[model samples]
Target: MLNFLKKKAALIWAGNHVKKTQDFKLNAEIKQEEQLLMMVRTAEKTLFGRQHHFEDIHSIEDFQERVPVTDYEGLRAFIEKMKKGQRNILWTDTPLYFAKTSGTTSGSKYIPISKEGMPFQLAGAQSALFHYIAKKGNADFVNGKMIFLQGSPELEEVYGIKTGRLSGIVAHHIPSYLQKNRLPSWETNMIDDWEAKVNQIAVETEKENMTLISGIPPWLIMYFEKLIERNGKKITQLFPNLQLIVTGGVNYEPYREKMNELLGGKVDIIQTFPASEGFFAFQDDYLQEGLLLLTNHGIFYEFIPLEEYGKPNASRLTLKDVELHKDYALILTTNSGLWGYSIGDVVRFISKNPHRIMVSGRTKHYTSAFGEHVIAFEVEEALKSTVAELAAQITEFHLAPQVNPTEGLPYHEWFVEFEKEPEDLNLFSLKLDDEMRKRNTYYDDLITGNVLQPLKITRLSRNAFHEYAKAAGKLGGQNKIPRLANDRTIADILSEYKI
Candidate 1:
């Protein structure tokens, strides 16, 4: 009876959120404009103050001049100030959680995400569901089990009080009645305690009827692999009613085919962009396209032209004025207390009617070693196409840039694992090179000697890269191999055979 009541309450809440989303969609254009003005006013009051630079800033260009660009270093300084109990330049209260992100290029940043700011994040996720339901003509998923494959919820205590990173804190905000009674308890564990927790989840979920699954793609992929290894083809037998699988935190494009094969190709897959800063956006039912922005929520959106980040005359755009099909670096000011924060990911606008966008890749996750800018997404696409053409089954792969001084050409070195060796390795490598040239003009120019040479491919043993990541402490939950390295430093680290 208790479980039934809890499920009922959860359904009611979901219905309310859906209703609100429908109303918002009906008034999207007007609401978007209104929200833009309100956000400008908020930015003036918080980020700019009464100074003339902050005032009378009617255009995106003017706003750019008033606020200087900030990276993780600047954010670190702000966090340090708060740690010493000093009045922070941003927020006044002690934050409820500090979300940790993977620090491949630098040390991990502990970003503060407050409790009052959580509702918007939750709403962003819910709105994605609303869009999905509308597209699929099904609203019956409100009562389904949602399994978030998130980090464990344990952290160091301060002043005899317990706190954790943002993901854990948000997990706590999940309505108690909606939570699975049979799942392993996250209230008292740290993410570092993975082995025990993985075992626990494996045991408990064996009997539970899970419907929704969420987590970083790499980790979830590892979990599914473990299940397959342990239970054989009986893995899906555990969750007979599974409907949707949601993944993020890292690129899912590379692992999509493999993941679908593992899950028996029965469930619908969706990707989301939920970060410690806020829930940015999510892929709705239009699974092949972009995510619709939650424009009127507690968050305000801004965009900097990707090519003009450090320029003195760089401009920014609000949600009301951004152009479709143009790539822009994202800057966000949220009710979560992050004012004019640059969260470091770049994205492109896909649609203007519903304010939909797609994450391109991170600002640093690109290779320009030979002046041929190849992003992570593009590389993943090229790999996917190449593998399909070769009829090869790739388990895992990584791309590293190699500069050849003798040839004066820069090329990508692909370390890939396959089920069986292709008949002709050289032909396979050339095919991948041809695919890259076809996809990217820059690579085509590089091949013609205007920029660089053709891309190279080296085959590794099946599960070789996975084993390497496991040995390096990046395997399983939340740890992912770097997809595109901008500099030789990360390249060196990835090239290392040992952890």
Candidate 2:
């Protein structure tokens, strides 16, 4: 009876919350303008703001003209000052926490999470759930166990502020009302060894009514594998109530087939676009294929044409300027004091009615050897289509260019671990090549012009990715295998595990 009342109350609250958010979605342009102005006004006296003449900025053009677009390297100096307990280096106040993440360009990046900005991050996540609840008209999941596979909550103090992975920092902010339903135990969560932690998590939650499982898709797959191995039963057979999955960090389409098989049934999924930078977007409607862009969240957004990314005169565009299906590099000026920061992601607007977007790829994570410029989405789409046609399942895959081959022309090398290998591996490779050519005109031209040969697939041993990640000291907790690489660095390392 108590659970029933709680669920009923939750449903009511969700309905109201969704309605409120709809208003903002409808007025996204105005909301964004307001948000930008508010942030500028609040941080006008800060060192970064003063340097950029934020007080003189009265319009989007003024702000854009004053602040130059930049990446992590551009903000490193300011971040260093903040790490040393300096106040107002970037924002009006010092940061409450620093979310630590491994960087591709640098060794480590510490992103500030200010007290003023943290609530929006939490709100965005909560709103995703509430939207799901309102749309599905179900809150039964709230009454059952929920697991968020994450980093250790134990934090180190950098100066006076807490410092840890974004997931770990978020652990401290889970609402008290739902605390009892969250898992695994504190001791299990604190375990640094990912394999050991996953084993403990599988044991701890196997008997519970797990309804919502949330994490990056790869690590969640690992946890699912652990559960099935230990119990010799499919995930749903053990939990029975498992219904919803919330995932981010990487695209989910490539892993969907395997995830469904592990679940033993079709389940609802909410794909989110979250980073240590901020929770940018989330799948608000299960029927939709794109995430609703959060214009009213404590951040102002800008987009630059992907093709013009590094050019000196690259156009900085607001929401009104974006076109459908056009790729843009995502940029931000946030309440956390990230000014005109390039988050390194490429996205496409699928809908403008409520501003829905699909994360296409990354600015830096692509294979451009031989000038073909193969992107993450193009390769993933190729693999997805081929898998569907061949009725095969992929455990994991990575793409890298082979600049020189011992016996043949250079080609794209695919490292794939298949759960269900096709009867004819050669045919599967040909089909994948065909799909790739259909998607990327540059790649097709290269193959036809004899600059590159058809792609080659190298089968990998089971758990090859696990071995690679372990060797790199990034085995779990938001770590993901790079989907595409320009050079052979990842390819040569993965070569050692080839079957």
Q: What is the lDDT of residue 485 in candidate 1?
A: 76
**Tens digit per residue, CA lDDT, model 2, 283-353:** 99987799999988888999999989999989999998999998899999999999999999999999998
* Alpha-carbon TM-score of each model against the true structure: 0.86, 0.99
Candidate 2: lDDT over CA atoms?
Answer: 0.92
Q: Which 10 consecutive positions of candidate 1 have the poorest summed lDDT?
A: 45-54
Give the poorly placed runs of model 1, Cα more than 4 Å off. Answer: 1-16, 22-62, 102-106, 137-145, 157-163, 187-191, 286-288, 405-409, 419-423, 471-473, 493-499
lDDT of 1 by residue, 373-445 (tens): 7776677778788777776666666677787544656668777766545678788889888888887787788
Q: Model 1 residue 240 lDDT? A: 70
lDDT of each: 0.66, 0.92
Q: RMSDs, each prediction?
A: 3.7, 1.0
In terms of lDDT, the poorest run of 10 residues in model 2 is 22-31
Candidate 2, residue 99: the lDDT equals 96
Badly placed stretches (over 4 Å) of model 2 are none
